[model samples]
Target: MTEAKRIPKRSEMDPKYMWDLTPIFESDDEWEKAFQEVKAYITQCQALQGTLGDSAESLLKGLRLQDQVNMKLLKVYVYAHLKKDEDSTNAKYVAYNDRASSLANDIQNALSFVVPEILSIEEDTITQFLQENEDLTLYRHALDEINRQREHVLSASEESIIARAGEVTSAPSNIFSMINNADMKFPRIKDENGEEQELTHGRYVHFMENNSRRVRQDAFEAMYDTYKKQKNTLAATLNASVKKNIFYSRVRRYPSALEASVQKDNVPSKVYEQLIQAIHEYLPVFHRYVALRKKVLELDEHHMYDIYVPLVQEVNMKYSFEEAKDLVLSSLTPLGEEYRDIVNKGYESGWIDVYENEGKRSGAYSSGTYGTPPYILLNYQDNLDNVYTLTHEMGHSLHSYYSRREQPFVYSNYTIFVAEVASTLNEALLTDHLLKTTEDKKRKMYILNHYLDSFRGTVFRQAMFAEFEKIIHEKVERGEALTPDSLSELYYDLNVKYFGPDMKVDEDIALEWARIPHFYYNFYVYKYATGFSAATALSKQILEQGQPAVDRYLQFLKGGSSKYPIDLLKQAGVDMTSPDPVRQALQVFEQTLDEFEALVLDK
Candidate 1:
């Protein structure tokens, strides 16, 4: 086997092919100019508080000015941060990020008076103001949502303190990223040809895709060993983050940190509980899949590292970037001509920064604000995983594109509760598309394996993370410490519950919690499971019911944050408030497992 060439440095690329930042600002001088303007607007925000209640006209004027300032600030901050995230190692970019974050904190502090002051006004008075003003009609949804949370809304001074302290609260997450990306180093693994390869975030998936079991096990153990060494420090950082949640919850009069975090997005605690219950009820299905893997691999005992090695040894399908684009277009055709056209533009235009360079951010994401095109950053290589990733990010981009086109700026940005749905929906459709078109038996088995792997990772694995997050928070809420030993014990037990009898839940695997960044976003992992469930339902509707389902799903995409996330998903024909969607999704998982089993038997 030939050695893979060293990845090129970012500076070696031609400037023209790089992302055009001029749409955000012409130069650093222009960004600095806007930064100064935003600073001046902070003073303008301070002038609005007392005068807002003087008269209806004064209130309207104050609110409009506040919205204008906020919109401008968003444009400035989002551009700076997105640019910085592309190459975070650059000192100039890091400084830009830090400055923009500080400016955001300052702006939040200055504008904290707006919500409380609005809430202080009599509800009937605000109602009459909305009835009288044409311009305020566009803000009806925004105002109503704020009013709905009137009981939880804080006074201006209190909110200002909280807003200003945002960066300090994010310290744990920031430190985790710094250590995980910049400091952690894994041992080199010997490949199939006995050549040594250094493990990296970009190459981890490639290593997992290797046909050799030894290579996969070496890569896994080498990576986890590094994490195991730093477990104590990571546990401390995570504990600090959990305590921050508890402190905020108590300060805000919420019953618990989980309640406080979930209620912000209008999610019920029952939704979180239901995810755990549904997954627990369906553990048999997961165990069955694991058993099938064990049988196929002929292992006397399946270890944790054995999970990722492909069940089907031969995968012949290879997709170049252009081929992946065409596949995404074909799979998404059910969404209509306009949707397809927008996706085409994302590919043709410079909306995507494709491929990994020396300093590009690891992993994949879809990010943009209301003022810019929804830009996708991907570390693309020619494989099925990259194809799925492209579809997923495009799902987010097109959702943003449609939402911004259809709604006002205030409503264009959707919540995270609904954010993953579009992305996962695309993944579901892409899998269905591949399974339908492929004729060769080996290719069919590969696609089926891919589908099963997605279900396992997104639904099952994330639910495990969710359960761990909930348990740790409850322990903190009950006055228990989050030491490395305590956390590892909790994590190890949960792994035993999730993976069942077929596999060994190893001691070192408990250290896995330290490596996952999502835990920092308290109570956030449950949404991944719920999002996949909702997407499975929506995709089935679009494929089986056709045009009417397509229209409803499109409406949900365009709804953005105009409605509550559950209400928005209800319009798409999935009632996530109930557990039926999750049950149905798990049923689909079972069916896929059955297919894989039969495919293996036939071969």
Candidate 2:
């Protein structure tokens, strides 16, 4: 008899497969030492609070000290959090992570006086300071950003109070993370070969994409059924989160939480509204794509579980990690040698945690600060979707790489608004490369299906999620409480509107809101849609226009937060302020859908 499968523990994995966190700190003991030193820096920073507006030199000195403390704080915080994410059930790292989070609040409380004090200085004096101190000129844009928030800047003591409230305000997200990552357990389900396999957050997607309807249905029901059991508790956590956003926005004197969030990116809230409008206009296009999927699969009734399975089942494209890396590198050759070389370096230099292990986080992301390698965490499965996941995350890491290499630490980090563009652009380039290279009809059809699904998930579905966030927050703003039933009902309705009548919006899918980690993020999912739109346009330019386009694109990656996200995209050859990019992306989706229909239907 064969043994049942189980997830391997972190220790069971080979050293080469793990990320080298030693670069951040040689060991946990070293990290603890750094942690103690940062606590001292926080005290020192608190001493310099009221001195920032005294003179240009004082202002520069205060700013530099704050930066110095933040630089160290970032390393300490990231190391602890990454270790915690590696194994959420590990009690040692959990305590370390909690303390690190509190340390972050302490640092924020320490430095909260800096912004209000800078805003108190006279405009003419600040200008003169810049003129007198050349070193102070580096913060020209940063100062301007602060001045723009002058209305929201509170008194020093008031700001400190809010800063210290950070841990309380962030509690909902933290609780959700712990429950989702460590406490939640999914049931075992049978795989395609009829062997019992434990369903996991990492394996859920793999099962959803299985060709067998029985397998897909079983996994879908099992996943959501688990969430359903905790639906009320999950609802309370989400309610607390929405209330948190409302609290901060009101405290900061913004009109709404949505406006407050966009203001940080220096983005107008109208852009967010415009993205939803454009997707609404193109809902028919998405509906048509769904119709085509149904016809191609020859299914009598299409459920949400049926949405993810590839239309071309004849070609189940799977790749080993090494093969996926090579394909991603080759696909990115159009970006010039330097860009490709950095991606190669990231692959070789221990910048990635390659596989999912017991208690590790699910999903993939690129994370780091200025001084560290832009590390990627991937729960890799040997499938084509995971290949796209690899490319997408490397897009982010490459953006981090370029920005850190080129910009000052002050400007090294980009906003969440423009972050998705780099990642989605990589996906587009990979799709383009695959289409051009594949001569076989089935493989090409398969590639088109993947591209179409990427659009549906990123643009249409995320826009749907964006709308849901807006609605839920608006309800909270109006003093309505969100119960499990109401939240599930609202989510179910949105799914129906977005998926169209041809698709069956299953009851199980309504509990999806409980499983999503992004909903806790203040108005963040919308950027995924906008980023997809911008990337579709930018990738077209790079493929069709060549070197000049590549040069412009490279410059955009290195821009960091030096310019507003809108202006950065303008430099990359797409204007996200208008609906043109979103429309252009939909047009590409239409074109792909048309071709896909011709091939599969004709065959």
lDDT of 1 by residue, 274-294 (tens): 999999999999999988989
Candidate 2 per-residue lDDT, tens place, 1-603, comes to 345588899889877878889889999999999999999997789889778888889999998998889999999999998999989989999999999999999999999999999988999999999999999999999999999999988999999999999999999999999889999999888888878898999999999899999999999999999999999899999999999999989989999999999999989999899999999999998998888888878889999999989989768599999999999999999999999999999988899999999999989899988899999999999999999999999999999999998999899999999999999999999999999999999999999999999998899989999999999999999999999999999999999999898999999888899999999999999999999999999999998999999999999999999998899989889988898888889999999999998998778
Compute each candidate's TM-score over C-alphas. Answer: 0.96, 0.99
What's the lDDT for residue 260 in model 1?
90
Model 1 weakest 10-residue run by lDDT: 13-22
The segments of candidate 2 whose C-alpha lies over 4 angstroms from its true place after superposition are none
TM-score, cand. 1 vs. native: 0.96
RMSD for each of the candidates: 1.9, 0.9
On TM-score, the leading prediction is 2
lDDT of 2 at 229: 93
